[model samples]
Target: MERLEKSIVITLCNLEKIFPPSFFTIMIHLVVHLASEAKVAGPVHYRWMYPIERYLLTLKKYVRTRSHPEGSIAEKYLADKSMTFCSRFLHNVETKSNRTERYFDGYYGASTHTSLTKLEHGQVHRYIIFNLDIIEIFRNLHIEDLKQRYVYDMINHFHIIDISFSYLFNIYV
Candidate 1:
């Protein structure tokens, strides 16, 4: 605003000879108040309507019908809020499901009994876990029963890669 005031004063002084004195009466006086506004309000952008503009943009997305935009946005907003409030108590409340199979819901592993030619003992291996959520649950329930089930499933289903840990926890817990 100080910069703005400086620019305005410089413009007025430079154009004093060319234009009539009456040309800089009302608007130029308004420009002079910008310096005082900076002292009171801190900055021009903060005092502006950016927050209201952003809120209006959010409301605009809820507008479906062109004929009655206000009604459309109001109804849609209320419906979404009500659904959000209601979904709190629901079980298996998946908001987004990009996968066809939710394999992470149960215990899963792979194993085989076929031995290589010269090995005296079975070769032990660790599975590469892809799902972090499954890994977290595995860490949380790292007790004897679930760990045993994991080993059993891995030995039984070595040829197949997928494993489900669902029922193992349900039975023990």
Candidate 2:
């Protein structure tokens, strides 16, 4: 613990040497006090307000009425609490909490297993590649490179066939 404090002090002093004094804000200054605070409080996670802040944020979302936010939040909170309690007792009803998980149930009408056939996989892969705007320039550059490489008669013949095949499978389709 003492070594850690010394290490932090040395590190902060080194940082001070490299960066201007004005760059050290309150947050940066707070780092020097963290080791002592951790020693006093045991651990940072035990003292975090994230869960309470998150729940408060959720409650804030329940406020539908602009003029009477407090009343809206209170009413929604009560309604949600009652609904949750009722859902616990009702086995047949499809409350949000009681519904099967989306992953297992395939709730979006998608298949549970994404086992595509080879042709389907190829089509999907080709669709994604062709749709990417950044790759269009690269694709054109590659076709130019192929034309340069296959300038000989026999290779040029194969290149013509390849070009016709690519034209048949154009984006215009």
Candidate 3:
């Protein structure tokens, strides 16, 4: 924004010099405020009439007869809603309402097994350590306690990693 603001102002200033003062109307000045206004109000879809307009357009498409659009829209809407309501109980057959997300991740409660390389494992650990937001004082105290305990036990790093993760795997499976 800092960089873009300078360019926007410069362009507007250039236009001011190129044209008469009367050319700079309220609408022209409002161009500078669009980005800031969108930031304050959030994306256009959330704050604007876009979703409502889209739904109305869909309803408009339901109009089959020129005599009464309201009746056609109402009839089609009720049919669609009733079918959606029924589609939930239809486990055997595929339906619009029961379709998976665009990028499907397999069926619900299903998962894939993955093996992480040592470098990938270290990267993940580093990411969590840097990004996790536990209270700083508590985290420091926990780390100090672990250091003291591990140092007192004089356990080698390899021995710690040798600890079996089978107990965790057993519980999950």
Q: lDDT per residue, candidate 2, 1-173, as tens digits? A: 77787798789889999999999888887887888888999887898999999999999999999899999999999999999998988899888788887678455665676789998986776665557796677556555665676664644464453454356446534
Residue-level error in angstroms, candidate 1, position 115: 51
In order, the Cα lDDT scores of the candidates are 0.63, 0.76, 0.70
lDDT of 1 by residue, 21-130 (tens): 98867766676677777888897788799899998999999999999998999999999888776766565765423323655675466765986553333222223232
Query: If scored against the real structure, what TM-score would every candidate get?
Result: 0.33, 0.50, 0.47
**Shift in Å, residue 107, candidate 1:** 19
The number of clashing residue pairs in model 2 is: 0
- Against the true structure, whose lDDT is highest? 2
Q: Which sequence of candidate numbers ranks them by TM-score, best first?
A: 2, 3, 1
Off by over 4 Å in 3: 1-8, 14-29, 35-46, 100-173
Q: How close is candidate 1 to the true structure, as a TM-score?
A: 0.33
Backbone clash count, each prediction separately: 13, 0, 0
**Candidate 2 lDDT for residue 32:** 77
User: Which consecutive 10 residues in model 2 have the weakest lDDT in total?
Assistant: 156-165
Over 9-122, each residue of candidate 3 has an lDDT whose tens digit, in order, gives 889999999999999989998878776776678777677888899998999898997699889899999998999999999998889977878897766876889999997986
Best by TM-score: 2
lDDT of 2: 0.76
Per-residue lDDT of 158 in model 2: 44
